[model samples]
Target: MCKNMKELQTVSERIFSLEQKKAQKKKEMDELEKEIKMLKNETSSYMKKRQKNELNIAGFTILFTAFARSSFDKDAFIAGESNGAELYRKYSKEIPMERVTVKVAK
Candidate 1:
């Protein structure tokens, strides 16, 4: 019948449209995967906190910053506050072998 033929045609068109949409999504996902892999190589990752130098503590939460630097106490990183940030508790007096910096995450 003509009616049956039309119905079959309509169903075929819908299936083709769905397949097109699925392919588009697959392409988008593949592009995103490539982008993520690229970013991973273009960045630095730290497994644990580490110091930048022997005299500086690198890992400190920067709540605030000002025109100031921490002065050495007894030739060691004792309790020192930077700008309005809290005085980070130093892990050891061995010239800060590890440093960590914290950022406020919204």
Candidate 2:
């Protein structure tokens, strides 16, 4: 019983240490992400001002282009069309999934 308790205590301490490290790394990552976003905005602005779509420098190519994406409105289609609901049910398939998570208390 004493040995088991010691093992549990060791595992719990390891989990706490890992959680602290994870939090520190997350903070560093957030700062880096912010800097990257600022740099990208500056580069994009420069490209747009020069009326350029692509820039090749230091063996890297950056593309700044405009595009349109098409998306279907399921609810609107179902309301507007007579056979929309049936078509949606016929095309859509439900898949079973299992997710596992571990949460440490602060």
Best by TM-score: 2
Question: Where in model 2 is the C-alpha error above 4 Å?
Answer: 1-3, 68-78, 81-106
Candidate 2 residue-wise lDDT, 17-96, digit = tens? 99999999999999998987777777767776888776666666676764444445454456456887776666555553
After superposition, candidate 1 runs with Cα above 4 Å error: 1-3, 45-106
Clashing pairs in 2: none
Where is the poorest 10-residue window by lDDT in model 1? 47-56
C-alpha lDDT of all candidate models, in order = 0.47, 0.67
Q: List RMSD in Å for every model shown.
A: 16.9, 13.0
Instruction: Look at candidate 1 and give me any clashing residue pairs.
Output: 50-99, 51-98, 51-99, 59-99, 59-100, 59-101, 60-100
7-106, model 1: which lDDT tens digit per residue? 9899889999999999999999999989866553332132223312222225533331112334434444443535222323342223422222344443
| Residue-level lDDT for 94 in candidate 2 | 55
lDDT of 1 at 56: 21
